[model samples]
Target: MRWTWIDRFVRLEPGRRATAVKNLSWAEDYFADHFPGYPVMPAPLILEGLAQTGGILVGHVHQYRKNVILAKMTARFHAEAHPGQQITYTVELLDLNEAGARVRGTATVHDKLLAEADIMFAHVGPEQLPAELADPQFVFSGELAHLLRQAESVISASSSSPPSAVTS
Candidate 1:
């Protein structure tokens, strides 16, 4: 099973920045073993979710040309996240090249910063691989469509106006 940590794309600003969310649920398998009775989300896993958000944004910048693999990270965790928290990861593009991309991001629960990191993504293999292999999103169009729908909803909702009260 291919695990997608982020649930929705709250914002995507092309080459500038992006924001995505992960809704932690009690039903997750890892929670049962993570801390026994006190289920706390692992720090590395939280960072992975953030990386996925950044990776997707970076892929958009490249139009899915090269593989975006995590090269390095300097992540600091400030708070523990429980099962019911919705973690929002906001990533800003620092730099990009054929070599890879550099992104800085922060994961937050509402207004509280849970974690922050500067992550680097690098191209994994030789220069000759086909785009299908180099950039993997194309291989799973059906699954990505569902994710895209969730993401698009967030983007559309942000630009939409609230319902007006009709006093008739």
Candidate 2:
């Protein structure tokens, strides 16, 4: 079964950055018997959310041809998330190339940082996402590719130097 986790995206972007929101609740199956009376959102799950957001950014930037995979992470949890709390995750790419992309992101609740990480993704074609996700009819991929191209255009324009040579 496709993990329902991917469906929880509240904010997703194809390029530049992506935001994801996860609402902690008692209804979650994982919380049911995790700790009985002292339940909390699992740390690993929080990291995955952040990773997913970053992965989406990388995949879109490369047009999904460079299969992006989570290569590594350096994550630190600063606070505990409780039931009913909403976690907002934002990821921004620091650098990107043919081989991989580096991103830094945070998950917060009420302006408090719950977790932060520097995540990396290695690029490969069709390997970044399963075949089911590679379909052209997929709305997310199409929308993301458009946005990513727009962002690239802006960056290219900003980086070009104005006419340098002077006419006689």
Candidate 3:
């Protein structure tokens, strides 16, 4: 299943970094059983949120030609987030190459850090992808479209390619 945990991009610097936000709501599906009386966002989901932010940064570098999958992560959680909290996830690219890239990120509420991680990704280009994902463009078309719309509306980074290049 393809699930994008981060809600929207607050900032996106191509090949450098990105910051996204996720406003937790009481209506979220998982809250019903996550703790019953003491509802809190799951740690794993938070990690995924951070990973998605880094993924978008890496994707911008590859020109949407690769599937930047999470290969490794060393994450630390310092606090729990309730439904009403809004998390700002910040991800910075540390290095990039034909093979993949490395990133460091943090999820924060207010000015305090709630969690952080150093994540590694494998940049599987179109030629290297499995048959199910051979069409790299379509594989990420939906996400790229949403992100592209967000990016164009916010920063007007005209140097980047438009999402419409990919057909439905």
**Which candidate tops lDDT?**
3
What lDDT tens digits, residue by residue, belong to model 3 across residues 1-168? Answer: 647788889888676678899999999888888989889999999999999889878877756667788899999999998899999999988888778889999999998888999999987666765678546665357755786568545543753443432211
In TM-score terms, candidate 2 sits at: 0.69
Model 1 bad stretches (over 4 Å): 124-145, 148-168
lDDT of 1 at 111: 93
- Kindly list the per-residue Cα lDDT of model 1 for residues 12-107, writing each as its tens digit: 766667899899998999899999999999999899989988887776654555566788999998999999999999998888766777899999
Give the C-alpha miss distance for residue 9 in model 3, angstroms: 0.5
Q: Score residue 127 of candidate 3 by CA lDDT.
A: 74
Q: Which model, 1 or 2, shows the larger TM-score?
A: 1
Instruction: Give me the displacement of residue 10 in model 2, in angstroms.
Output: 5.5
lDDT string, candidate 2, 57-89, tens digits:
667664555557788999999998888988888
Better of 1 and 3 by lDDT: 3
Clashing pairs in 2: 65-125, 66-124, 67-124, 67-125, 67-128
Model 3: which ten-residue window has the lowest total lDDT?
A: 159-168
**Residue 30 displacement (Å), model 1:** 0.8
lDDT of 3: 0.81
Q: What is the C-alpha RMSD of each candidate to the true structure, in Å?
A: 8.7, 7.9, 5.7
Give per-residue lDDT, candidate 3, residue 73.
99
* Residue 121 CA displacement from its true place in model 2, Å: 0.7
